[model samples]
Target chain A: MKAIALKLCSVTGMKWGIPFVKLFSGEEVLEQLKEIWGTVGIPLIAIVTFLLIWHFGAKQIDTSLGQVPGPAMVWEQTKALWAEHVDERIKADEFYARQDARNAAKLAKNPNANIRVVDYTGKPTYIDQIFTSLKTVFMGFLIASLIALPIGIICGLSKKIMQALNPMIQVFKPVSPLAWLPIVTMIVSAVYVTNDGWLEKSFIISAITVSLCSLWATLINTALGVSSVNEDYINVAKVLQLSPTKKTFKIVLPATLPLIFTGLRISLGVGWMVLIAAEMLAQNPGLGKFVWDEFQNGSSQSLARIMVAVFTVGIIGFILDRIMVELQKLVSFDKKTIA
Target chain B: MALLELHNVSKGFGEGKYRTEVLKNINLSMEEGEFLAIVGFTGSGKTTLIKMISGLLSPDEGEILFRGNPVTGTSHERGVVFQNYSLLPWFTVYENVALAVNERYPDWTKETKDIHTRKYIEMVNLTPALNKRPAELSGGMRQRVSVARALAMNPEMLLMDEPLSALDALTRGTLQQEIINIWTKDKRTALLITNDVDEGILMADRIIPLTTGPNATLGPEFRIDIERPRDKTELNDNEEYKKTRNDIIEYLMDMGAEVKTKKTTNYRLPELKPIMPGKTFRKRKEEDKLKYF
Candidate 1:
């Protein structure tokens, strides 16, 4: 049962739970304690120390809004944000219920009347903004991956193609999301003229900008990875008389997948970061927009709320990175320890 | 008819002043079911010869024929066991073997492929390590998997590039015996490239010396007329084994001396030293018929 528990923890990526499982199972008590202290206790202590420092620092510092938000203020703002989210959800539910009743009455009054249930277009809550940001970043990341992987493979396979792409990659790689924003905005506004489309114009602009900025990392890394695939494996593929497509998919792709995942992880992180900046600058509906709005409002609570948003952005980024790493581990057959 | 033949093959790398010729006017032919070993110095283009026959490389000049057809590109007909084991590190021993078996016998049922893969894995005595990846296996075991992978392809011919050179002595000896046992069971045309003279004698029917490079060519052939299933310990005292070993070593040493003398003379005639073809340990007789400058 203890062995099963340990296995379950490992599979779930809850490796920190192993110590507790072992301790409960009457394994070496001291060893389990050491493992727990190294993995969990150390991190908890560090967090507490950081919070103490922030509390002390908050008293000394003064901002234009008021004081720098301490741990307590940030915690309070976090609770307030959660309450706002709940209140918004309740209001949406009530609005939908009222709409349904009104629609039924309209239908009863006139049998052939158009009785449409309109959507609740309330101001998005903090939770809703978080989801918006996640969606935008994912859309951008997906587009980047779709475009970059094939191009990278082509560049890797042919030296001439790589040479042709070299100058373009060099020129575009360092261009910031801020630099891409104006061009992306102009093109999206000019081309995407449809109102009430599946995606908002602002969302499309931000996503395209994110994709443009983030694709370089994946493209370069993927090219490097594909080129570095073992020559012996290629020779084996040749010896087997595998077709071109089979060789690429079966031998080349699998061999370079670990590095490709590394590239993807970087691209996702870059996309997320670029999305936040794009949202702030473009006034798109996301956490970045929320932060900007609160700052412009300049209330006492505004500083604490912005602090909450800051912590939220950090935690979400950490989670996104962890997800990519987990996915990489699942796909890579070479199970070497990764940092 | 020869199963594989190389005719006046010449290969070089680099350009102009940096150009180094690795093989020149290399002529060789092998029949079906014959085990031929080419022993050479470290950089003597033995691998180039093997690659030429395997069709991974094409000679800059001359033609390589496989059963009278010109060899153009790599084919499953010639299976290669590279000096480095070349097993995909991600794949298990069983998967590595099964990959080749499936490729070669695509029409075979999954069950048949599995059984075929297992047969060769068992032949290499790696049944216990079937599920283990290459990284988990020792050097010898990894090489065994490579050997198994190649054999599972069921190719018409086998090309081994010093396959046991990376192994320790005991493992090398054990694998050598395993190879001989497999060869005896299925008499496939085989070419082995090695620097180890004893290995060549122990495993091959005829051992040919590959001269030191900047244009290496095959020297005189030494036929090993020793009986089948020859024991190494017993052969240590055998007069025939000792004499043949000494003769081959003497020729290689002479070639080494020739290389030292070659540095002073920028352009010189290549020696046409020839020895008796079969079952003789006599010294090489300088044949005047062949000449190259």
Candidate 2:
């Protein structure tokens, strides 16, 4: 049972829990305590030290708006943001209830009274913006993967294809999201003619920009991974006389999965970074836009709110990376490649 | 027609000043159900030769034939067990074997394939580790899995490239016996490559030596006329086994010496005397005299 729990901890990137589990099992108590201190206690102390530093440091800095908001002010802003979201949700519910009552009254007064229920069009809350950012980033990441993985595999398989595409890949890899945003915005505006389409134009622009900037890491890493599959494994495939497709899926892909997941982790991180920049630059409705708007608002509380968004973005990025690590661990056979 | 044939086959690598002829004029033939072993020193193009027969590699100058047809590419008809085990690390023992079985008998039902895979795994006595991945297995067990995978394909011919060399002595002996037992059951055409003369003589009906490289080729073939089920202990007493083993060893040693002589280069030596650290030679002699007194 302890072994299973330890394995679970490693697989889920919850390695901090391992020492606790081991401590509970009462084996090598001193060692477990040391491990617990290293994994959990040290990190806790470090966080406390950082917060104390930030709290003291804020008093020394004087910006044009005011002194930089400390941890306390950021916490207040976070709570304020959550409270505003809750208040907006309550208002929306009341609006819906009032409309439903009015519709029922209209129907009772006259059997065929023309009654229409309009959709709520309230400004998005901070939580709503966070979801929007997540959705946008995921969509962008999916698009990048869909484009990168097949091309990467083909490039890995055939030298001629790689040679043909290498120059373009090199040229485009270093191009920033900032550079792609305007081009993507123009193209999206010209191509996306429908105003009432399922997707919003701003959303599409941000997603496309993210895809453009994020695909390179996945492409390069996957190609490298595929090309570097062990020669012995390839020989085994040949001995079996597997079909081209079967050989690729069975031997090449499985062998290169660790590297591919590494590429994906990098790609998702790039996509998330690119997504925020794109959303901010494009004035799209997401956390990036929220941050930018708060900066422009320049109110005393706006700086603290923007700091809250910064922390949110950083934490979300960390969680995304951790998720990819877990997925990589689950798929990869080689344990040494986990980190 | 021979089960397999190689005619005037030569293979090399690189080009221009860096070119090397790794194998040259390698000619061999095997009839149906023949157990042939090619013994050679390390880096003598043994693996290169086996790969050619398995169709993973093509000879630069000559063609390889199987059953009177020109060999083109790898096929399930010739299954190879590589030197490094080469079991896919991601796959369990069962999956590693099942992969080949599935590819060979694609039309078979899933259940049938599973049974066939399990049978081969059990043949290698790996039923306990059926679900264990290659990374989890020991070197010997991994090689067993490799052997099982090759055998599960039901190939007409089996090619093994130093499959047991990575294993410990005890494991190597057990796997060697298991392999022989499997080979003798159907007597499928088998080719085993190794540097060990005893391994060749014990398992092969015919043993051939591969000379040291830079144009390594097959030397004279020795026929192992001993009866089947040749026990390792009894082989020590068998006159024929001793004669064949000595002859092969003598021939190999002579070739090794010849190569050493051909490649040897003399270098001038510097005259230097050994001295104890932190003391002159006279001081050391004085200390030795005092210690004796």
Candidate 3:
């Protein structure tokens, strides 16, 4: 049972739980106590200290509108956001139910009656905006990965290809999402002419901007990873008389997966950050837009509400990074490769 | 026809001022079902020779013929066991072996491939480690998996490049005996590259020496002529084993000495005397006394 618990903790990247499990099992009590203090207790104490500092520091900092929101104020705003989301959900449900009932009645009264259900046009809540941001970032990250991986692999395999792409990659890599947004907006508007496409133009613009800003990380890391694969493994592939496709998928891919995952982790992070900035600039419907809207509102509670969005973005980014780490650990053969 | 032949084959690296002829005028041929071992010092182009034969590398000067046809790129017909175990780290022992089996016999059913993979893994005494990845296994165990993977391909010829060199003595002995047993069971054409004379003697029907490099070539061939099931302990006491061992060692030592002499550069040194620290301190003290006076 102790072993199982420890294994579960390790697998989930919750290594702090290991000492607790070991302590419970009555093995090396002193060492386990030290481990617990170092991993769990210290971090908890640090967080509490940070909160206390923030709580005090917030009272002194005054912006043009008001003072910065303390932790308590931010907490209150978080609850308020939840309450708003719940109320909006209930209203939406009621609207849909009423519309369905009226449509049914109309159909019953006249069998061939032409009745259309009106769509709910409610303002998106804080929670909805968060989901929207997540969706957009994922779309952007997916696009970036798709573009980066093949090119990266080819560049890794061939010296000539890598040489050709290196300069372009260097030039584009440092360009910010703010710079990309205008170009992407123009191109997306010009090329994507359909008004009733599956994706909105603003969403496409934000996603494309994110992809443009984020893809360089994945591309460079993947090429490095692919090129640095152990020569012995390549020789094994050769000795096996494997086809080029088989050699790549079977040998090269697996060998370079850890590095590829590192690249992906960076790409996803860049994509998320870029997506938010793009959304803010483009006034797209996401957390960035929500933040921008609250800033423009200039109400008493607006500062706290924006503070809520800040914490939400930070926590989500951390969670996304953790998710990538866990995914990398799952696929990587060596535990040491998890970084 | 010879099972495999290398005629006037030479390989070199770089060009112009930096050219290094790693292997030159390497000529060798192996008969069907014969086990040949090439014993060379480290950096003596042993690996280069084996790689050329396995078709992983091309010879610059001459052709390598397999069954009277010139060898081209790598083929499933020639399987190689590398010095460092090259089993994919992501794959378990079973998967590593299965990969070779699947590639070699693509027409075979999955069940047949699985059975074949398991059989070779069992041969290497790695059945218990079938689910273990290369990282989880010891050096010897990983090498065993590498051997299993190569054997599972069912190649007409096996090329092993110092496969047991990294292993501990006991593991090396065990693996050597296991390899000999497998070879005797179905005498496939096999080439073993090693720096160990005893290993070459124990495993091969004929042992050939590779000269020291910068332009290394094959030395004299020594037929083991020792009886099969050659016990390592008994070989120490055997007259023929001692004679053969002495001759090979002497030949290698002579070549080593010759290379050392040929490559040795004489440097002229300036004659100088060491200054005594105590004398220098006394001289400083005398000068201080004079200044005080």
- List where candidate 3 sits over 4 angstroms from the true fold: A1-8, A24-26, A94-116, B109-115, B261-293
CAPRI-style grade of the A/B interface in model 1: medium
Error of 1 at B43 (Å): 3.8
Q: Candidate 1: misplaced stretches above 4 Å? A: A1-46, A97-116, B16-18, B90-95, B101-133, B136-138, B168-171, B213-215, B250-293
**With candidate 1 superimposed using the best TM-score fit, by how many Å does residue A66's alpha carbon deviate from the native?**
1.2
lDDT of each: 0.88, 0.91, 0.90
Chain A only: list TM-scores of all candidates: 0.95, 0.95, 0.94
C-alpha DockQ of every model: 0.54, 0.74, 0.69
Q: Rank the candidates by TM-score, best first.
A: 2, 3, 1
Candidate 3, residues B74-187, lDDT tens digits: the string is: 988898999988889888889898888988899999888888889999999999988998888999999989888888888999999999999999999999999999999999
By lDDT, the candidates rank as: 2, 3, 1
Cα error, candidate 1, residue B60 (Å): 3.8
In model 1, state the lDDT of residue A148. 94
Q: What is the DockQ of candidate 2?
A: 0.74
Mind giving the per-residue lDDT tens digits that candidate 1 earns over A238-299? 88788888788878988998989999999999998888899887777998799989989999
lDDT of candidate 1 at residue B213, scale 0 to 100: 96
